[model samples]
Target: MKVFVYGTLMQNHRANFLLSRQKYIGPGEIYGFSLYKVSNWYPGVVPREGDRVKGEIYELIHEAEKTLTRLDDYEGEGSLYQRILTKAVDQKGEEHEVFVYVYNGTVDEEKYIPYEQQPWRG
Candidate 1:
């Protein structure tokens, strides 16, 4: 399974620990969504026309199921964030269907970090 990560899970971030064993496909971008920082800890992506979020695509090689379970817990799936399968475009322009954890809670606009200052440094 492949997952698209934009914040803490990106390379050199705090949560990279969970992704160290996965195969990094490459840099990717998801269109039609906006990425926002939540309390400076992590990012939440919401659907927004004409918006795009930069991220990295990782493929789970050996422990797909187990890794997904852990990732779900980390992202607070079913509560704070919701896991959804979405299309992401790689640097080469190829599209991929990848799971992304999107914010399910109410957003406070004041905390939104613009794309120019992106990839939230939590």
Candidate 2:
């Protein structure tokens, strides 16, 4: 299984331990969505026309199901964030269907982070 990750799960950020054993598929981008700083430590992505969120893709080669379950817990699936299958385009412009965790609750107006500036900076 392949998973798309932004925010902390990206290359050098924290929470990467969850993917330490996974195969790095390279940088990728998901279109028609915008990323916002939901908090000081993480960002949330929501659907928006004409927008794109940059991230990386990984292939879970071993214990794929267990890895996904752990990711669900880390993401607070069904509450804080919801994991969904979506298309992510790689640096080479090739698209692959991957799972991404999206914000599930209401977003505070004051916390809105524009796409021009990367919101993953902690």
Candidate 3:
């Protein structure tokens, strides 16, 4: 399965720790979506013109579904983020539809900044 991740799962960011344990095929980006800060972490959503959410796309092993769902749970899928199908780009420059976690309406737009500008934790 193809998964799109912005925020901490990009390269060596904090959340990448979790992704590292899984079988990731490559890196990529997802357009038409934007990222935001939720508490100390970040989540993404469908975008407007001025918004750009940058991240990597990973192809998971078929057996990794359970692990991926657990990640969704951790991200608060039902509340903070809703899993949605969107277009994402891969390190090979291929575009495809993948599942991504997006922020729900509960998030205040004024609070989030670009994930690249944030400090990371060990």
Candidate 4:
């Protein structure tokens, strides 16, 4: 399956080891989501109407389960983040159903990350 990554897991950053071996499809935009600064090193996303988030898409292969499990723990799934199936439009205008990590908590109005800025660049 494809995964949408907008923060440390996108291109170059820490905690991206899990995606190092995966096939990078391309850049994409996931609609109905908003990005926010979670910390200095990472950003979190949440579902929101009329919003969009930019990120890269990767196809998970080779021990997908293990990688996903590790990512779950790292992302604090069920607490800080939750894995969800969402649709994203790739650079080629192709829509893909991808798994994305979304913030589980409430988004503060002060923490909104605009599209013009890198999500993790706090």
Candidate 5:
């Protein structure tokens, strides 16, 4: 399955270290979502019209979905972040639906910095 990842999981981040050790198929870009930084700790990308979130597209290999599920669980999925299907567009302007996680629960949107203003370099 193809999955879109922004935030710490971008191609050149600490999170990629974990991803590199996984059974992933490939990496690409997915657009059409708006990236945001929540509470200056993590990232969130939401599907929005006329918005584009630049991130890496990964194809999970074999049963990588199960591994991903565990990763999500470790990240507090369904609580801190909820996995959902959303449309993402690539750099070439191509669109595809992929599974992604968005910050949920009681996130303070007002405190969220725009993706460009993300404070965490990690």
Candidate 6:
């Protein structure tokens, strides 16, 4: 299965160890979502018209895929974030339907980060 990673899980980020074994599918962007700095440790995203979030796509092996549950727990799936199916455009302009983690809390306008400055670096 494929997943879109925008923040901690993106390449070169501190939390990338989570998907170090997964196959990177290259850079991709999901539209209709705005990225925000949820905290000093990570970022959150919410759906917003005319917005986009840039990130990377990875293919998880069957065994590695099971780690998603762990990732969920780590992400506080029921509260901090939610995994959802969404469409993303790859570097080649190909559209792909993939799983992505989205923010589950109220957004703060001051925390909003522009698309070009995404994949949230603390």
Q: What order do you get sorting by lDDT, best first?
A: 2, 1, 6, 4, 3, 5
Pairs in clash, predicted candidate 5: 31-89
**Model 4, CA-based lDDT:** 0.85
Q: Which scores higher on TM-score, 3 or 6?
A: 6
Every model's Cα RMSD, please?
1.2, 1.4, 3.3, 1.4, 3.5, 1.3
- List TM-scores for all candidates, in order: 0.93, 0.92, 0.74, 0.92, 0.70, 0.93
Superposed Cα deviation of residue 22, candidate 5 (Å) = 5.4
Q: Runs in model 4 with CA error above 4 Å?
A: none
Per-residue lDDT value at 53 in model 2: 85
Q: Write the per-residue lDDT of candidate 4 for residues 23-53, one digit (tens) a residue.
A: 8898899999889886766789988899899
Write the residue-wise lDDT of candidate 3 on 5-56 in tens digits: 7766668776676676665656566665555555654555545555556666
Span of 10 residues, lowest total lDDT, candidate 3: 113-122
Q: At residue 3, what lDDT does model 6 achieve?
A: 86
Better of 2 and 3 by TM-score: 2
lDDT of each: 0.87, 0.88, 0.67, 0.85, 0.62, 0.86
Better of 5 and 6 by TM-score: 6
Tens-digit lDDT string for candidate 6 (22-46): 8889999999999998888889889
Write one digit per residue (lDDT tens) for candidate 5, span 28-74: 34445555666555677655556555566676764687768766865
lDDT of 1 at 43: 78
Q: Candidate 6 clashing pairs?
A: none
- Scanning candidate 1 in windows of ten residues, the lowest lDDT window is 113-122
lDDT of 3 at 93: 76
